[model samples]
Target chain A: MSDAKKFMYINRKAPYGTIYAWESLEVVLIGAAFEQDVSVTFMDDGVYQLTKGQDTTGIGMKNFSPTYSALGDFEVTKIYVEKESLEERGLSLDDLQHLVWEDEDEDYAEKDSIRLVSRAELADVLAGQDVLFNF
Target chain B: MKLTIQVNEGPYQHQSADTAYHFAKAALEKGHEIFRIFFYHDGVNNGTRLTTPPQDDRNIVRRWSELAEAHNIDMVLCVAAAQRRGIVDDGEAERNGKDATNIAPGFRISGLGQLVEGGIESDRLIVFGD
Candidate 1:
Protein backbone atom coordinates (compact mmCIF):
# COMPACT_ATOMS: atom_id res chain seq x y z
CA MET A 1 0.00 0.00 0.00
CA SER A 2 2.88 2.31 0.72
CA ASP A 3 4.32 1.82 -2.74
CA ALA A 4 1.61 3.75 -4.57
CA LYS A 5 3.23 5.35 -7.60
CA LYS A 6 3.03 9.09 -8.27
CA PHE A 7 0.93 9.71 -11.40
CA MET A 8 0.52 13.19 -12.85
CA TYR A 9 -1.78 14.19 -15.71
CA ILE A 10 -0.56 17.30 -17.49
CA ASN A 11 -3.30 19.21 -19.32
CA ARG A 12 -1.97 21.69 -21.89
CA LYS A 13 -4.82 22.02 -24.41
CA ALA A 14 -8.09 23.86 -24.40
CA PRO A 15 -11.24 21.86 -23.69
CA TYR A 16 -13.92 21.37 -26.41
CA GLY A 17 -11.54 22.58 -29.13
CA THR A 18 -10.00 19.12 -29.10
CA ILE A 19 -11.01 15.81 -27.54
CA TYR A 20 -7.71 15.48 -25.69
CA ALA A 21 -8.82 17.43 -22.63
CA TRP A 22 -12.00 15.39 -22.16
CA GLU A 23 -10.34 12.04 -22.86
CA SER A 24 -7.53 12.94 -20.49
CA LEU A 25 -10.09 13.57 -17.76
CA GLU A 26 -11.66 10.18 -18.49
CA VAL A 27 -8.31 8.50 -17.82
CA VAL A 28 -7.94 10.30 -14.51
CA LEU A 29 -11.46 9.33 -13.50
CA ILE A 30 -10.81 5.69 -14.34
CA GLY A 31 -7.30 5.62 -12.86
CA ALA A 32 -8.62 6.88 -9.54
CA ALA A 33 -9.95 3.41 -8.61
CA PHE A 34 -6.37 2.14 -8.30
CA GLU A 35 -5.78 4.49 -5.32
CA GLN A 36 -2.48 5.84 -6.59
CA ASP A 37 -0.97 9.22 -5.70
CA VAL A 38 -2.61 11.24 -8.48
CA SER A 39 -2.35 14.92 -9.36
CA VAL A 40 -3.18 17.20 -12.33
CA THR A 41 -1.50 20.21 -13.91
CA PHE A 42 -3.15 22.94 -15.96
CA MET A 43 -0.90 25.03 -18.18
CA ASP A 44 -1.01 26.88 -21.51
CA ASP A 45 -4.47 26.77 -23.06
CA GLY A 46 -5.45 24.05 -20.60
CA VAL A 47 -6.08 26.71 -17.96
CA TYR A 48 -9.26 27.61 -19.85
CA GLN A 49 -10.71 24.25 -18.83
CA LEU A 50 -10.91 25.29 -15.17
CA THR A 51 -12.57 28.65 -15.76
CA LYS A 52 -15.73 29.39 -13.74
CA GLY A 53 -18.20 29.79 -16.61
CA GLN A 54 -18.23 27.46 -19.63
CA ASP A 55 -21.37 27.35 -21.75
CA THR A 56 -21.13 24.92 -24.65
CA THR A 57 -24.79 25.07 -25.62
CA GLY A 58 -24.27 26.61 -29.05
CA ILE A 59 -21.26 24.39 -29.75
CA GLY A 60 -23.34 21.20 -29.32
CA MET A 61 -20.75 19.64 -27.04
CA LYS A 62 -21.07 18.13 -23.60
CA ASN A 63 -20.21 20.68 -20.93
CA PHE A 64 -17.84 18.53 -18.90
CA SER A 65 -16.46 21.47 -16.95
CA PRO A 66 -18.68 20.54 -14.02
CA THR A 67 -16.88 17.20 -13.76
CA TYR A 68 -13.78 19.03 -12.49
CA SER A 69 -15.64 19.73 -9.31
CA ALA A 70 -15.96 15.98 -8.60
CA LEU A 71 -12.28 15.13 -9.08
CA GLY A 72 -11.68 15.64 -5.36
CA ASP A 73 -14.20 12.88 -4.68
CA PHE A 74 -11.80 10.56 -6.51
CA GLU A 75 -8.89 11.61 -4.25
CA VAL A 76 -7.31 13.75 -6.95
CA THR A 77 -6.62 16.49 -4.42
CA LYS A 78 -3.64 18.19 -6.02
CA ILE A 79 -4.72 20.39 -8.91
CA TYR A 80 -1.89 22.66 -10.07
CA VAL A 81 -2.47 25.81 -12.11
CA GLU A 82 0.64 27.55 -13.42
CA LYS A 83 0.89 31.25 -12.52
CA GLU A 84 2.50 32.24 -15.80
CA SER A 85 -0.08 30.35 -17.81
CA LEU A 86 -2.85 32.28 -16.09
CA GLU A 87 -1.03 35.58 -16.53
CA GLU A 88 -0.40 34.93 -20.22
CA ARG A 89 -4.11 34.32 -20.68
CA GLY A 90 -4.92 37.50 -18.72
CA LEU A 91 -6.61 35.47 -16.01
CA SER A 92 -6.46 35.36 -12.20
CA LEU A 93 -7.53 32.89 -9.54
CA ASP A 94 -11.01 34.43 -9.41
CA ASP A 95 -11.56 33.48 -13.07
CA LEU A 96 -11.14 29.80 -12.20
CA GLN A 97 -13.48 27.51 -10.31
CA HIS A 98 -12.78 27.43 -6.55
CA LEU A 99 -12.20 23.66 -6.45
CA VAL A 100 -11.94 21.88 -3.09
CA TRP A 101 -11.97 18.37 -1.67
CA GLU A 102 -13.37 16.91 1.54
CA ASP A 103 -10.81 15.47 3.95
CA GLU A 104 -12.06 12.34 5.66
CA ASP A 105 -9.07 12.15 8.01
CA GLU A 106 -9.83 15.62 9.35
CA ASP A 107 -13.46 14.89 10.29
CA TYR A 108 -14.73 15.60 6.75
CA ALA A 109 -13.31 19.08 6.61
CA GLU A 110 -13.12 20.88 3.26
CA LYS A 111 -9.62 21.51 1.86
CA ASP A 112 -8.63 23.59 -1.14
CA SER A 113 -7.43 21.50 -4.07
CA ILE A 114 -6.28 24.03 -6.67
CA ARG A 115 -2.73 25.23 -5.98
CA LEU A 116 -1.51 28.17 -8.06
CA VAL A 117 2.26 27.94 -8.50
CA SER A 118 5.08 29.53 -10.44
CA ARG A 119 6.49 27.72 -13.50
CA ALA A 120 9.80 27.16 -11.65
CA GLU A 121 8.00 25.54 -8.71
CA LEU A 122 5.98 23.30 -11.07
CA ALA A 123 9.24 22.09 -12.66
CA ASP A 124 10.20 20.58 -9.31
CA VAL A 125 6.74 19.01 -8.99
CA LEU A 126 7.13 17.52 -12.47
CA ALA A 127 10.49 16.02 -11.54
CA GLY A 128 8.97 14.23 -8.53
CA GLN A 129 6.28 12.32 -10.45
CA ASP A 130 6.85 8.66 -11.23
CA VAL A 131 4.63 8.74 -14.30
CA LEU A 132 3.33 11.63 -16.41
CA PHE A 133 0.34 11.58 -18.81
CA ASN A 134 0.06 14.64 -21.02
CA PHE A 135 -2.88 16.03 -22.98
CA MET B 1 13.62 -1.68 -18.59
CA LYS B 2 9.90 -2.26 -18.83
CA LEU B 3 7.87 0.32 -20.68
CA THR B 4 4.30 0.96 -21.84
CA ILE B 5 3.50 3.09 -24.88
CA GLN B 6 0.32 5.02 -25.50
CA VAL B 7 -0.63 6.05 -29.05
CA ASN B 8 -3.31 8.73 -29.22
CA GLU B 9 -3.71 9.42 -32.93
CA GLY B 10 -4.61 7.47 -36.04
CA PRO B 11 -1.83 5.65 -37.86
CA TYR B 12 -1.88 7.56 -41.18
CA GLN B 13 -2.84 11.20 -40.72
CA HIS B 14 -0.63 11.61 -37.67
CA GLN B 15 2.92 10.37 -37.19
CA SER B 16 2.39 9.39 -33.54
CA ALA B 17 1.41 5.80 -34.39
CA ASP B 18 4.40 5.33 -36.67
CA THR B 19 6.72 6.84 -34.08
CA ALA B 20 5.27 4.66 -31.35
CA TYR B 21 5.59 1.58 -33.51
CA HIS B 22 9.25 2.28 -34.25
CA PHE B 23 9.95 3.07 -30.60
CA ALA B 24 8.38 -0.21 -29.51
CA LYS B 25 10.38 -2.12 -32.11
CA ALA B 26 13.58 -0.44 -30.97
CA ALA B 27 12.81 -1.22 -27.33
CA LEU B 28 12.26 -4.87 -28.15
CA GLU B 29 15.46 -5.01 -30.18
CA LYS B 30 17.37 -3.58 -27.20
CA GLY B 31 16.17 -6.43 -24.90
CA HIS B 32 13.55 -4.39 -23.06
CA GLU B 33 10.18 -5.53 -21.84
CA ILE B 34 7.00 -3.96 -23.25
CA PHE B 35 4.29 -4.10 -20.64
CA ARG B 36 1.56 -3.03 -23.09
CA ILE B 37 0.64 -0.63 -25.90
CA PHE B 38 -2.67 1.07 -25.29
CA PHE B 39 -4.53 2.65 -28.23
CA TYR B 40 -6.69 5.53 -27.17
CA HIS B 41 -8.73 8.38 -28.70
CA ASP B 42 -8.29 8.25 -32.46
CA GLY B 43 -5.55 5.71 -31.80
CA VAL B 44 -8.20 2.99 -31.74
CA ASN B 45 -8.53 3.44 -35.52
CA ASN B 46 -5.25 1.51 -35.89
CA GLY B 47 -7.03 -1.67 -34.80
CA THR B 48 -9.30 -1.92 -37.84
CA ARG B 49 -8.70 -4.83 -40.18
CA LEU B 50 -10.39 -3.12 -43.11
CA THR B 51 -7.52 -0.73 -43.76
CA THR B 52 -6.49 -0.81 -47.40
CA PRO B 53 -3.28 1.09 -48.01
CA PRO B 54 -1.48 1.40 -51.35
CA GLN B 55 0.22 -1.84 -52.40
CA ASP B 56 3.55 -0.04 -52.78
CA ASP B 57 3.37 1.57 -49.34
CA ARG B 58 3.95 0.13 -45.88
CA ASN B 59 0.98 -1.44 -44.15
CA ILE B 60 0.61 0.17 -40.75
CA VAL B 61 -2.00 -2.12 -39.19
CA ARG B 62 -0.31 -5.26 -40.46
CA ARG B 63 3.05 -4.10 -39.19
CA TRP B 64 1.63 -3.63 -35.73
CA SER B 65 0.03 -7.07 -35.83
CA GLU B 66 3.27 -8.67 -36.93
CA LEU B 67 5.30 -6.92 -34.25
CA ALA B 68 2.84 -7.82 -31.52
CA GLU B 69 2.79 -11.45 -32.60
CA ALA B 70 6.57 -11.65 -32.81
CA HIS B 71 7.12 -10.07 -29.40
CA ASN B 72 3.97 -11.38 -27.71
CA ILE B 73 3.10 -7.82 -26.79
CA ASP B 74 -0.24 -6.95 -25.27
CA MET B 75 -2.04 -4.44 -27.52
CA VAL B 76 -5.23 -3.00 -26.16
CA LEU B 77 -7.70 -0.38 -27.38
CA CYS B 78 -9.81 1.61 -24.99
CA VAL B 79 -13.25 -0.08 -25.14
CA ALA B 80 -15.25 3.12 -24.81
CA ALA B 81 -13.14 4.85 -27.39
CA ALA B 82 -13.22 1.83 -29.68
CA GLN B 83 -16.96 1.58 -29.38
CA ARG B 84 -17.39 5.22 -30.24
CA ARG B 85 -15.06 4.76 -33.19
CA GLY B 86 -16.80 1.54 -34.36
CA ILE B 87 -13.74 -0.69 -33.88
CA VAL B 88 -15.49 -3.84 -32.79
CA ASP B 89 -14.40 -7.44 -32.33
CA ASP B 90 -16.63 -10.45 -32.97
CA GLY B 91 -18.15 -10.42 -29.52
CA GLU B 92 -18.60 -6.69 -29.58
CA ALA B 93 -20.09 -6.84 -33.03
CA GLU B 94 -22.63 -9.39 -31.89
CA ARG B 95 -23.39 -7.59 -28.64
CA ASN B 96 -23.71 -4.21 -30.28
CA GLY B 97 -25.85 -5.59 -33.13
CA LYS B 98 -23.31 -4.64 -35.75
CA ASP B 99 -23.28 -6.79 -38.90
CA ALA B 100 -19.51 -7.20 -38.93
CA THR B 101 -16.47 -6.64 -36.78
CA ASN B 102 -13.47 -4.63 -37.91
CA ILE B 103 -10.84 -5.26 -35.18
CA ALA B 104 -7.52 -6.33 -36.58
CA PRO B 105 -5.16 -8.89 -35.14
CA GLY B 106 -2.91 -8.07 -32.13
CA PHE B 107 -5.42 -5.71 -30.56
CA ARG B 108 -8.18 -6.25 -28.02
CA ILE B 109 -10.71 -3.89 -26.46
CA SER B 110 -10.36 -3.10 -22.77
CA GLY B 111 -11.07 -0.41 -20.20
CA LEU B 112 -8.81 2.53 -19.38
CA GLY B 113 -7.69 0.64 -16.26
CA GLN B 114 -5.30 -1.41 -18.42
CA LEU B 115 -3.40 1.79 -19.21
CA VAL B 116 -3.36 2.76 -15.54
CA GLU B 117 -2.12 -0.71 -14.57
CA GLY B 118 0.55 -0.55 -17.25
CA GLY B 119 1.75 2.81 -15.94
CA ILE B 120 1.94 1.37 -12.45
CA GLU B 121 3.64 -1.88 -13.44
CA SER B 122 6.05 -0.62 -16.08
CA ASP B 123 9.31 1.20 -15.43
CA ARG B 124 8.18 3.98 -17.77
CA LEU B 125 5.06 4.98 -19.69
CA ILE B 126 5.69 6.99 -22.84
CA VAL B 127 2.94 8.81 -24.73
CA PHE B 128 3.09 9.81 -28.41
CA GLY B 129 0.54 12.30 -29.74
CA ASP B 130 -0.61 15.88 -29.94
Candidate 2:
Protein backbone atom coordinates (compact mmCIF):
# COMPACT_ATOMS: atom_id res chain seq x y z
CA MET A 1 0.00 0.00 0.00
CA SER A 2 2.92 2.33 0.60
CA ASP A 3 3.94 2.13 -3.06
CA ALA A 4 0.45 2.68 -4.45
CA LYS A 5 0.56 3.88 -8.04
CA LYS A 6 -1.53 6.84 -9.14
CA PHE A 7 -4.43 5.36 -11.12
CA MET A 8 -7.01 7.61 -12.77
CA TYR A 9 -10.24 6.71 -14.56
CA ILE A 10 -10.96 9.36 -17.18
CA ASN A 11 -14.66 9.57 -18.09
CA ARG A 12 -15.59 11.58 -21.20
CA LYS A 13 -18.99 10.19 -22.14
CA ALA A 14 -22.54 10.54 -20.82
CA PRO A 15 -24.53 7.85 -19.03
CA TYR A 16 -27.34 5.50 -20.25
CA GLY A 17 -27.19 6.29 -23.95
CA THR A 18 -24.08 4.16 -24.40
CA ILE A 19 -22.53 1.44 -22.25
CA TYR A 20 -19.33 3.40 -21.76
CA ALA A 21 -20.46 5.27 -18.66
CA TRP A 22 -21.86 2.23 -16.87
CA GLU A 23 -19.00 -0.05 -17.86
CA SER A 24 -16.52 2.61 -16.86
CA LEU A 25 -18.08 2.72 -13.41
CA GLU A 26 -17.97 -1.06 -13.25
CA VAL A 27 -14.24 -0.99 -13.91
CA VAL A 28 -13.69 1.61 -11.22
CA LEU A 29 -15.62 -0.38 -8.64
CA ILE A 30 -13.73 -3.56 -9.43
CA GLY A 31 -10.40 -1.79 -9.56
CA ALA A 32 -10.90 -0.63 -5.96
CA ALA A 33 -9.57 -3.97 -4.73
CA PHE A 34 -6.06 -3.01 -5.82
CA GLU A 35 -5.88 -0.35 -3.07
CA GLN A 36 -4.02 2.03 -5.31
CA ASP A 37 -4.04 5.85 -5.19
CA VAL A 38 -7.11 6.11 -7.39
CA SER A 39 -8.93 9.15 -8.81
CA VAL A 40 -11.79 9.78 -11.24
CA THR A 41 -12.20 12.67 -13.66
CA PHE A 42 -15.52 13.93 -14.99
CA MET A 43 -15.16 16.07 -18.08
CA ASP A 44 -17.04 16.65 -21.34
CA ASP A 45 -20.31 14.73 -21.23
CA GLY A 46 -18.92 12.70 -18.35
CA VAL A 47 -20.02 15.55 -16.09
CA TYR A 48 -23.60 14.37 -16.60
CA GLN A 49 -22.85 11.08 -14.80
CA LEU A 50 -22.66 12.89 -11.44
CA THR A 51 -25.89 14.89 -11.75
CA LYS A 52 -28.60 14.43 -9.12
CA GLY A 53 -32.17 13.13 -9.36
CA GLN A 54 -31.50 10.38 -11.87
CA ASP A 55 -34.61 8.42 -12.93
CA THR A 56 -33.77 5.46 -15.15
CA THR A 57 -37.05 3.61 -14.91
CA GLY A 58 -38.26 5.38 -18.02
CA ILE A 59 -35.16 4.14 -19.89
CA GLY A 60 -35.64 0.59 -18.57
CA MET A 61 -32.12 0.67 -17.17
CA LYS A 62 -30.63 0.43 -13.71
CA ASN A 63 -29.99 3.87 -12.26
CA PHE A 64 -26.29 3.79 -11.36
CA SER A 65 -25.81 7.46 -10.48
CA PRO A 66 -25.93 6.70 -6.77
CA THR A 67 -22.82 4.59 -7.14
CA TYR A 68 -20.74 7.75 -7.17
CA SER A 69 -21.26 8.10 -3.44
CA ALA A 70 -19.95 4.56 -2.85
CA LEU A 71 -16.68 5.44 -4.55
CA GLY A 72 -15.55 7.22 -1.40
CA ASP A 73 -15.92 3.98 0.52
CA PHE A 74 -13.67 2.27 -2.01
CA GLU A 75 -10.79 4.55 -0.96
CA VAL A 76 -10.99 6.52 -4.19
CA THR A 77 -10.88 9.92 -2.55
CA LYS A 78 -10.18 12.17 -5.49
CA ILE A 79 -13.04 13.00 -7.85
CA TYR A 80 -12.06 15.74 -10.26
CA VAL A 81 -14.73 17.73 -12.08
CA GLU A 82 -13.50 20.12 -14.76
CA LYS A 83 -14.85 23.64 -14.39
CA GLU A 84 -14.67 24.41 -18.11
CA SER A 85 -16.56 21.29 -19.07
CA LEU A 86 -19.27 22.08 -16.52
CA GLU A 87 -19.61 25.68 -17.69
CA GLU A 88 -19.73 24.63 -21.33
CA ARG A 89 -22.62 22.35 -20.50
CA GLY A 90 -24.37 25.02 -18.41
CA LEU A 91 -23.64 23.24 -15.14
CA SER A 92 -22.01 24.26 -11.85
CA LEU A 93 -20.70 22.46 -8.82
CA ASP A 94 -24.15 22.70 -7.26
CA ASP A 95 -25.60 20.58 -10.06
CA LEU A 96 -23.43 17.61 -9.08
CA GLN A 97 -23.50 15.26 -6.13
CA HIS A 98 -21.79 16.29 -2.89
CA LEU A 99 -19.41 13.35 -2.51
CA VAL A 100 -17.21 12.98 0.57
CA TRP A 101 -14.70 10.57 2.06
CA GLU A 102 -13.58 9.73 5.59
CA ASP A 103 -9.97 9.95 6.71
CA GLU A 104 -9.28 6.99 8.98
CA ASP A 105 -5.93 8.43 9.97
CA GLU A 106 -7.67 11.52 11.36
CA ASP A 107 -10.22 9.59 13.42
CA TYR A 108 -12.45 9.26 10.41
CA ALA A 109 -12.83 12.97 9.74
CA GLU A 110 -15.21 13.57 6.84
CA LYS A 111 -13.70 15.34 3.82
CA ASP A 112 -15.03 16.50 0.48
CA SER A 113 -13.67 14.38 -2.37
CA ILE A 114 -15.06 16.33 -5.30
CA ARG A 115 -12.35 18.70 -6.40
CA LEU A 116 -13.40 21.40 -8.87
CA VAL A 117 -10.49 22.45 -11.05
CA SER A 118 -9.92 24.42 -14.24
CA ARG A 119 -9.08 22.61 -17.50
CA ALA A 120 -5.42 23.59 -17.12
CA GLU A 121 -5.34 22.30 -13.57
CA LEU A 122 -6.92 19.03 -14.65
CA ALA A 123 -4.25 18.71 -17.36
CA ASP A 124 -1.56 18.95 -14.72
CA VAL A 125 -3.34 16.32 -12.66
CA LEU A 126 -3.58 14.03 -15.67
CA ALA A 127 0.12 14.38 -16.30
CA GLY A 128 0.99 13.25 -12.78
CA GLN A 129 -0.80 9.91 -13.11
CA ASP A 130 1.14 6.61 -13.26
CA VAL A 131 -1.74 4.79 -14.96
CA LEU A 132 -4.73 6.31 -16.76
CA PHE A 133 -7.72 4.08 -17.57
CA ASN A 134 -9.49 6.13 -20.24
CA PHE A 135 -13.14 5.69 -21.04
CA MET B 1 8.53 -3.52 -22.16
CA LYS B 2 5.78 -5.44 -20.40
CA LEU B 3 2.43 -4.30 -21.82
CA THR B 4 -1.25 -4.89 -21.24
CA ILE B 5 -4.13 -4.12 -23.61
CA GLN B 6 -7.77 -3.39 -22.92
CA VAL B 7 -10.09 -3.66 -25.91
CA ASN B 8 -13.40 -1.88 -25.41
CA GLU B 9 -15.03 -2.62 -28.76
CA GLY B 10 -16.18 -5.80 -30.45
CA PRO B 11 -14.66 -7.34 -33.54
CA TYR B 12 -15.62 -5.70 -36.86
CA GLN B 13 -18.07 -3.35 -35.19
CA HIS B 14 -15.22 -0.91 -34.58
CA GLN B 15 -11.53 -0.65 -35.42
CA SER B 16 -10.48 -0.87 -31.78
CA ALA B 17 -10.15 -4.65 -31.62
CA ASP B 18 -8.28 -4.78 -34.89
CA THR B 19 -5.89 -2.03 -33.85
CA ALA B 20 -5.27 -3.68 -30.51
CA TYR B 21 -4.46 -6.98 -32.22
CA HIS B 22 -2.04 -5.29 -34.56
CA PHE B 23 -0.47 -3.37 -31.74
CA ALA B 24 0.02 -6.51 -29.71
CA LYS B 25 1.49 -8.31 -32.69
CA ALA B 26 3.87 -5.45 -33.37
CA ALA B 27 4.91 -5.39 -29.77
CA LEU B 28 5.52 -9.13 -29.68
CA GLU B 29 7.43 -9.01 -32.93
CA LYS B 30 9.66 -6.43 -31.33
CA GLY B 31 10.33 -8.91 -28.45
CA HIS B 32 8.07 -7.08 -25.99
CA GLU B 33 6.13 -9.06 -23.40
CA ILE B 34 2.34 -8.85 -23.22
CA PHE B 35 1.45 -9.23 -19.58
CA ARG B 36 -2.21 -9.62 -20.45
CA ILE B 37 -4.98 -8.65 -22.85
CA PHE B 38 -8.12 -7.98 -20.89
CA PHE B 39 -11.26 -7.42 -22.98
CA TYR B 40 -14.13 -5.40 -21.56
CA HIS B 41 -17.30 -3.51 -22.60
CA ASP B 42 -18.34 -4.76 -26.06
CA GLY B 43 -14.94 -6.36 -26.38
CA VAL B 44 -16.30 -9.46 -24.69
CA ASN B 45 -17.68 -10.36 -28.08
CA ASN B 46 -14.18 -11.25 -29.15
CA GLY B 47 -14.25 -14.38 -27.01
CA THR B 48 -17.32 -15.99 -28.57
CA ARG B 49 -16.54 -19.16 -30.56
CA LEU B 50 -19.80 -18.87 -32.53
CA THR B 51 -18.53 -16.33 -35.03
CA THR B 52 -18.52 -17.36 -38.71
CA PRO B 53 -17.29 -14.88 -41.23
CA PRO B 54 -17.03 -15.21 -45.02
CA GLN B 55 -14.32 -17.54 -46.24
CA ASP B 56 -12.46 -14.65 -47.87
CA ASP B 57 -12.48 -12.49 -44.75
CA ARG B 58 -10.06 -12.53 -41.86
CA ASN B 59 -11.59 -14.45 -38.96
CA ILE B 60 -11.12 -11.97 -36.15
CA VAL B 61 -11.99 -14.23 -33.24
CA ARG B 62 -9.77 -17.01 -34.60
CA ARG B 63 -7.07 -14.43 -35.13
CA TRP B 64 -7.14 -13.59 -31.44
CA SER B 65 -7.23 -17.22 -30.36
CA GLU B 66 -4.28 -18.01 -32.56
CA LEU B 67 -2.34 -14.98 -31.40
CA ALA B 68 -2.85 -15.80 -27.75
CA GLU B 69 -1.92 -19.45 -28.31
CA ALA B 70 1.23 -18.49 -30.17
CA HIS B 71 2.39 -15.93 -27.67
CA ASN B 72 0.97 -17.65 -24.62
CA ILE B 73 -0.74 -14.40 -23.82
CA ASP B 74 -3.24 -14.20 -21.00
CA MET B 75 -6.32 -13.13 -22.95
CA VAL B 76 -9.25 -12.51 -20.66
CA LEU B 77 -12.81 -11.32 -21.24
CA CYS B 78 -14.36 -9.57 -18.30
CA VAL B 79 -16.95 -11.85 -16.65
CA ALA B 80 -19.53 -9.10 -16.13
CA ALA B 81 -19.13 -7.75 -19.61
CA ALA B 82 -19.16 -11.23 -21.12
CA GLN B 83 -22.25 -12.23 -19.16
CA ARG B 84 -24.08 -9.09 -20.24
CA ARG B 85 -23.24 -9.77 -23.88
CA GLY B 86 -23.84 -13.56 -23.71
CA ILE B 87 -20.22 -14.70 -24.01
CA VAL B 88 -20.00 -17.77 -21.80
CA ASP B 89 -17.28 -20.21 -20.85
CA ASP B 90 -17.75 -23.81 -19.70
CA GLY B 91 -17.47 -22.96 -16.00
CA GLU B 92 -19.60 -19.87 -16.42
CA ALA B 93 -22.19 -21.82 -18.34
CA GLU B 94 -22.51 -24.39 -15.57
CA ARG B 95 -22.70 -21.69 -12.91
CA ASN B 96 -25.20 -19.49 -14.75
CA GLY B 97 -27.27 -22.43 -16.05
CA LYS B 98 -26.47 -21.57 -19.62
CA ASP B 99 -26.99 -24.53 -21.96
CA ALA B 100 -23.88 -23.83 -23.98
CA THR B 101 -20.59 -21.99 -23.82
CA ASN B 102 -19.42 -19.66 -26.58
CA ILE B 103 -16.01 -18.57 -25.35
CA ALA B 104 -13.15 -19.23 -27.77
CA PRO B 105 -9.83 -20.91 -27.11
CA GLY B 106 -6.87 -19.08 -25.52
CA PHE B 107 -9.34 -16.88 -23.67
CA ARG B 108 -10.94 -17.06 -20.25
CA ILE B 109 -13.53 -15.17 -18.23
CA SER B 110 -12.28 -13.21 -15.24
CA GLY B 111 -12.97 -10.17 -13.06
CA LEU B 112 -12.05 -6.54 -13.65
CA GLY B 113 -9.39 -6.93 -10.98
CA GLN B 114 -7.33 -8.55 -13.72
CA LEU B 115 -7.35 -5.28 -15.62
CA VAL B 116 -6.28 -3.39 -12.53
CA GLU B 117 -3.50 -5.90 -11.95
CA GLY B 118 -2.35 -5.38 -15.51
CA GLY B 119 -2.18 -1.66 -14.91
CA ILE B 120 -0.13 -2.20 -11.81
CA GLU B 121 2.24 -4.85 -13.13
CA SER B 122 2.71 -3.87 -16.75
CA ASP B 123 5.13 -1.29 -18.07
CA ARG B 124 2.23 0.21 -20.03
CA LEU B 125 -1.50 -0.38 -20.07
CA ILE B 126 -2.93 0.60 -23.47
CA VAL B 127 -6.65 0.97 -24.12
CA PHE B 128 -8.41 0.62 -27.48
CA GLY B 129 -11.84 2.14 -27.18
CA ASP B 130 -14.56 3.76 -29.24
Candidate 2, CAPRI quality class derived from DockQ: medium
Chain B, candidate 2: TM? 0.99
Span of ten consecutive residues with least summed lDDT in model 1 chain B: B90-99
Models 1 onward score TM values of: 0.98, 0.97
Shift of residue B53 alpha carbon in model 2, Å? 0.8
Candidate 1 docking classification: medium
Q: What is the DockQ of each candidate?
A: 0.77, 0.72
Residue B109 of model 1 has an lDDT of 92
Residue pairs whose backbone atoms clash in candidate 1: none
TM-score (0 to 1) for chain A, all models? 0.97, 0.96
User: For candidate 1, lDDT tens digit of each residue in B2-41?
Assistant: 9999999998899999999999999999999999999999
lDDT of 2 by residue, A1-135 (tens): 347899999999999999999999988998898888899999999999999999999879999999999988998899999999999999999999899999999999999999999999999999999999999
**Winning candidate number (DockQ):** 1
